[model samples]
Target: MPSDTLNQFLNDNLNELKEQGLYNEIDVVEGANGPRIQIDGRDLVNLSSNNYLGLATDERLKEVAKDAVDSHGVGAGAVRTINGTLDLHVQLENKIAEFKGTEAAIAYQSGFNCNMAAISAVMDKNDAILSDALNHASIIDGCRLSKAKIIPFEHSDMDDLRQKAKEAKESGQYNKIMIITDGVFSMDGDVAKLPEIVEIAKEFDLITYVDDAHGSGVLGKGAGTVKHFGLQNEIDFQMGTLSKAIGVVGGYVAGKQNLIDWLKVRSRPFLFSTSLTPADVSATTKAIDLLMESTELQDRMWENGDYLKKGLKELGFDIGNSETPITPCIIGDEKTTQQFSKRLNEEGVYAKSIVFPTVPKGTGRVRNMPTAAHTKEMLDEALTIYEKVGKEMNII
Candidate 1:
């Protein structure tokens, strides 16, 4: 029995979303979301996962995870502050610090929680956050939780950031000012101008926060966007994830020892949530070790990306400006974008359409993430399906 007010609120919003074609119907993947996947009894080439390095299915990670299960059983019993912090957790944090070239690092349950914990823990009512307009939803929520004045600068617009940062700094309205941005804009897949951002931060005495969720294991030879730009020491907070490239699940913040120390004690998620399970932590450590050992997987990922992007372009698709392996075929209308994705699925490719709310209206696209696991043959096959679908949908 629900209240009339509650029912009305739900019905109104549901109707609005449904009318706008924004109500998403999720499709379940029957197996791993590899280069090829199974959904609804059909085999489709998956182009939507963030597993750039393809380590998610690597034998080494499996070995590590199994070994962890044998040694440590399953879950962490309590929050990290109580009995959840195992030796594996410490080792994983240390491995992260080594991988990120930082003095220390702290792990979180998820990359989303990293933002939720880090931002609110440091910046408060007296502080202000200068955020990039196209930053992730986690970043937006984090800023709100901090109770700080969130000033949005145009995407990658350093000039505007400088102007606003100066205004915020001089107003005497805030005690601390922080400039936060995604290391790689996920929608556009463009790398952030970290060198210019660091300069601006220095000029304004602003704390720098870089959430490198997409950049880790993709850029900087798998270190991250900061290291890719050779500004590791300049950036105050370097946030990364174990889920994407690492092929595991978790996030980390690496920086000076004092920052890590403060976050460990104060970051809300770290203080309240259970630490990562033994298997996840173990597999993540193996992933980092593999990344550090060689760039073979990274090279393969880029090779596949280039091959796929070239084929998409040749097929008369409008692949957007993406410097990374990420490819987006721009389709102008939301309905058309959804149709394109449905056609792709029917034709055996699994690239999903991204429409409004994720990007501006009329900027609908089918975003593809090509990974190291894809072979030349697989990509060519997928490209052929894309071409067939494009012709059928008259998208090209």
Candidate 2:
């Protein structure tokens, strides 16, 4: 007594994925995702966490969470439009604005929700969005939800973007046009050409948007990509995740006062969804404060990235073109990449394989995330394992 259509579709999709060797099996981390992680009852050098700044387990952030829990209980009572906008929310937003060099800021429950809320709130069917081809899935969905004509410019292709923006303006295909891109490409770790992007935007009078989820805690001495390029005022939307480098949970948008004002009233997620809990909000504030305080974590993260990339490249393995700390050990076949990950797991390293759908087919790679928490000892051990596995798999 099964629903025939639903069951058939699910089974068909599952079978297809399995046949294509793309069916992913999930792994369990027994405890905290630290630099050294316990996976399936073994200690492994973890190189797959976005906890780049190691603030996820920082003592100061923990204390802030404890204090908030004691003072504000657990959850915000209701949605922001209802009874949920606590004084802490206002305080956190203010700190974020100051840190991001913006007139105002607003937080969302998650980074994905930030895109969902911000895009549709400002633009609609009458408008159009010029988005980068490799923009995050959240951004793509946000554009779709807005009912806007999504014009995907080539990835980091300035000439292509300029041509497309010019054509869109001339055709009068839609209303407002905004260009959105990730400040740093997460998988490849290459930075977006924001200076060129901004110049194009000014020429076309297009609104500039950058989702600096990966760049905030790493670039511009922790001020983020907009500040790195000295275009903080030129960009219209500065969206980011508190979860990544901030090492907390949530997202935000920093921009002009009027833009923030409009979003506060119009953004569906901000208005309808309940706000982040007191603990999360307060810890995030502490994270921003910490980043402003010192460059220790950012510096350590770069050291580790360079160390790992150098070691891997010396082993004669292809480490793709990466401008940031993200390191990918390129393995051309999906099944082989997964097998290599499995073999590395046996050798006490926990870098994960990224395959088709995340990247183009035949470009499968084992993506590594070297964080501030990783020590030279840990990285050396991981490098030793990578060398062994690369040779065993004939990948070097």
Candidate 3:
């Protein structure tokens, strides 16, 4: 029933992607995604997941989720604007607000949804958004959805941002100007210069938005990059994901009560989409509780990250300038980078190759995500495999 034109387009593009080595073949994880994973019945040292705090598989979270399922059933039954808003959802929002040190918070189904909802909710055709060059795809897409004039400044170039802000403000072309950036650049693992950004926003009177998807539960003692720099009050939108470090399936924006109230009323996703299930809300609340209660997991996660980074760096791999636990082993050529990841898989490592569209054209890399669940022995084994493979491929 497919049209010939559509089939031709699909085939041509699929062939082009495969020929150019840009095609990403997703691997199936056979069990719970933890420090060690099983793919095709082969055990792998997992370094590709966003479960930063190891809470995804935590027994406490599992128990709470199961209890929620028993009590509330599986689904929310309808959209939030109807009768889908549950007490569990309210609790999760309140917990997120408390954990992030914000006056209030509103939850979304996912982090990507949060960006899509939040950005377009506040910004429109009359507004302008100053975005970082290397922000996440979701942020880029969200900005585009807002129909605002998107002015991209060089990655972390404060001077470029200030110049753009000055120009945008002085031109009087926009009714409102907003500066948006990732709290941590996910691909290269560099922390955003929030202190300088806040200063610029204050000077230009630009609304500040920080998408802290990667920074939440990783920095600021598990608070996030905003609280890491003590700028929770300064940033207008402190957006983050529960799926990353919080180890749940949702996202949220924590800020002033007025902003939260406005988002609840205006954000389309929160209004129209089916609400998060009781299990997810309950488990996410418990994750935030755990994060607020102790930093022991985060401490372990840091130690593991340092260990992996040191091992790779000592092996002469270009481990880019990462300020956090996310590590990217840069291997310039796309095919070679893919080959390196393929070899790693064969050797029991699961660090995936990030190429072209994910990063720059020639800066292909194998991004490693170390978590609190990874044992030192597992890392040592992975390092040994890296040594063997790097030598085999002359990548070292």
Candidate 4:
């Protein structure tokens, strides 16, 4: 049997989370995650997915992935350094470099692993990192893993960042300093002030890293946030994921050739973990090709996002300031937020509640992600459901 102390700790914490409505009860999706999904034998409008471009179910990518499976088999048999690096992997990395307008790029198994590998590989105990307070959990974990002096600045506050950067540089206690931020904050959908951040980094001689996981294929005509601000040449690291915008399952870091070379040899995940499978690599390459071919999907996504935001705003619900397609309906109370999401699900909408630890306490919300695949009819139906639920609960 497991230790009683461990069992007690688990029981106590689980009970506390359940009582406060903080315990997440994950619902199983019956099919591909798209604009609509099935759960418990019922179909619901899905506004909780990160499939912004709707390419996850694209026929072109599917066909390519199938071809890759036939040609290259199911898996990359070994770690990248130990021969798992196939021709498909090289092709994907090249395509990523082309898409990101970087000298070179390296792919990873996941966005979280990319952060974990990249940050710790470069920065160390002797270094300092000026991180945004609202950065993702992955970025926080990465910084912690680096064992760097992490000084968090206020979110999007350039002055705060400048002060922190100046202090870190002037302290002369660190061998190196890096400024890391999410190009687009996923929670509230606010874009980072990259231009200002770049200016500060330059003044302080700090390395710049932009995790554009949410911004890729959604901004800068699909090149990403660095290109969105025309800072491709200025930013040192342009990190992104193939999973979200590209509608595939991988992550990557795009930078100068030297940086890519270093990460190839030094990044733990790339060195020790198996490379991406043929299907994922090929599918991701196709997705990037589609993104670069035209901006039709990206444009439609913005239109749908604007339409949804306008509808939510007109209904008098406190949809927070979201610059992107991610819309958050603030409910204030944690249990109320969870209840609101449950009602949304019951009424055929599948948005999820995000509460404490994700966002600050007292700001619990139901995050609605309107993808490009959602037709106007779907949006209208979702809005109608929102209206009914909002009025019933007096949320409006």
Candidate 5:
């Protein structure tokens, strides 16, 4: 039996969340998460996935993954330091390094783990991190785990970042100072001012770190945000996920050989957690290869994004300022945004609403991720549904 104390505590919090309209009910997809997905036996156009290049379900990646599984086993039997670092893992890291234009790279179980590992590995109580206000939760947690003083600047405000960097550097109260940001802000689809950030880092002599999870397969012709600005060598840490654009599962930090060596030696996750499976490593390697070979998938993804944004704007939706393929239709009120997303799902489009806490209180939105896999017909259908629902709900 469960402890009464634990049950009561959980029940009370859950009841409060339900009353505030903050409780989330997850919808389960019935099959592979692709351009279209089935939920509750209804087919719906999926605009909520991070498969920017449509490589998650690509046949070539599938074949490689299957072959790896047949040749190797399902799991990496031990922690990486204890012999779980398979040849496939090494190959994946090498591929990541080459693709990112870095001297070397290190892989972790997931993008989330990469943050926890890398941040804590290098930073400590004597260090300070100047972080962007809108960085991901993983980055926040990682910074905390480092036990370093965290200084947050206004989102994408170069002036604010420079001011904070100056204060931290001149104070001389910390051994090291690092500036961290999301290469692409996920909520608004607006890109980070990397050029300005690099300039600031250079002036302050601060180490630069970018979490390029959303930018990896969508920016820099699919190389990433660092390469987008041709600052691959300037940035100290280039962290990204294999799960998002790569269409696999894992994360990595690409940088100088010294940084990679230090992470391998000190990162707790790499030392304690088992490495990624052979299949995941092989598939990720192949995905990077495809990305390097051509930019067709990224081009298609951008085309879909442009079409969606134009259609929504024509229908009187306030799409935010997004330079990337990530489209957020701002709906203002939280309840309205949730209702809008619900209507979209009911009408055959599957876009999830991002409400308060995830974003600001009144700036709720329905985030649409246009992938390369979506067809023009599918997007057109989605636009029609949006118009119908927007008019019916008085949103347009």
Candidate 6:
């Protein structure tokens, strides 16, 4: 049995969440999360996964992963600082550096962990972090863990960032200042105004960091947003994930040799946690090699994105200002948005509703992720269902 105090706290919080309509009931996908997913034995047109390039279920990656497991086993045995650093891990890091156009790179268990490790490794009590208002939760937690003064600028507002940066620098209170933002804002699919942000960083002598989790496999011909703007040398930290686009499970921080050296020594997760398995390392290396070899998958992903966007627009759905493949059909009220998603699932589509806290209140939306693996037939079916449901809900 749980402790009385803990039980009571959990119950109260859960009840409050339910009453506020904020409880999220997770769905169980029975098979691989691909262009089509199975739930309760029913296959649905999958538009909810972050498998942007469809490499998660790629045969080549699977073959390499299996071969690695046979050669190196399933686990890295100890913490990275101890005996866990394998040859495959070193090779993977080198591949990441080459892929991102950085001098050196370091990998973490997850993108969230990378943020936690990298932020606290450098910035601390005497520092300040000027973060975007709508940055990912991991970024928020990372900044807090640094024990630094955090000032949030309005989302994608360059003027606000510039003003905040100026104020923070002129105050002379912090020993160091950093500006952090997502390379691609996941919720709205908007690209960050990195050029302007870089200009501000230069003016204030601020350290620049961009979390390219969503942009790594989808932008700049699969190189990412830093490369998209040709500002590879300007950004201090280029953080990315292997999970979403690479169809694997890990994250990385790529930068100069000095920064990578600092992180290797100071990053808590790198020092304390076990390194990635040999299979993950080898498969990730293969994924990077594939990305470097061709732009076929990235190009297909964009084409699919454009096709879906045009279909949704023609069906009279409002997809907010998105610059990437992520599509969000705005449906103001939380309950209605939830109902719309429910109907979509019933009609054989798998898009999910995102509401309050994940997004602003009263701006609930159904987020759609179109991957390179999705067929035109699958998209056509999804659009047909969407049109039917929209009209039925009087949304279109």
For every candidate in turn, the CA RMSD to the true structure comes to 1.1, 0.9, 0.7, 0.6, 1.0, 0.9
For model 1, residues 150-212, the per-residue Cα lDDT tens digits are 999999998999999999999999999999999988988899889999999999899999999
lDDT of each: 0.92, 0.93, 0.95, 0.94, 0.94, 0.95
lDDT of 6 by residue, 94-127 (tens): 9999999999999999999999999999999999
Q: Total backbone clashes of model 4?
A: 0
Q: Model 4 misses residue 275 by how many Å? A: 1.5
Better of 1 and 4 by TM-score: 4
Error of 2 at 232 (Å): 0.5
Candidate 4's residue-wise lDDT over 104-178, tens digit each?
999999999989999999999999999999999999999999999999999999999999998999989999999
Ranking by lDDT: 6, 3, 4, 5, 2, 1
Question: After aligning candidate 1 to the native by TM-score, how far in Å is the CA of 257 from where it should be?
Answer: 0.7
Q: Which pairs of residues collide in model 6?
A: none
Model 2 agreement with the true structure over 150-219: per-residue lDDT tens digits: 9998999999999999999999877799999999988788999999999999999999889999999999
Local error of candidate 4 at residue 68 (angstroms): 0.4
Give residue 86's error in model 3 in angstroms: 0.5
What ranges in model 6 sit over 4 Å off? none
Those runs of model 3 whose alpha carbons end farther than 4 Å from true positions after fitting are none
TM-score between model 1 and native: 0.98
**Clashing residue pairs, backbone N/CA/C < 3 A, model 1:** none
Worst 10 residues of 2 by lDDT: 17-26
Decoy 6 TM-score against native: 0.99
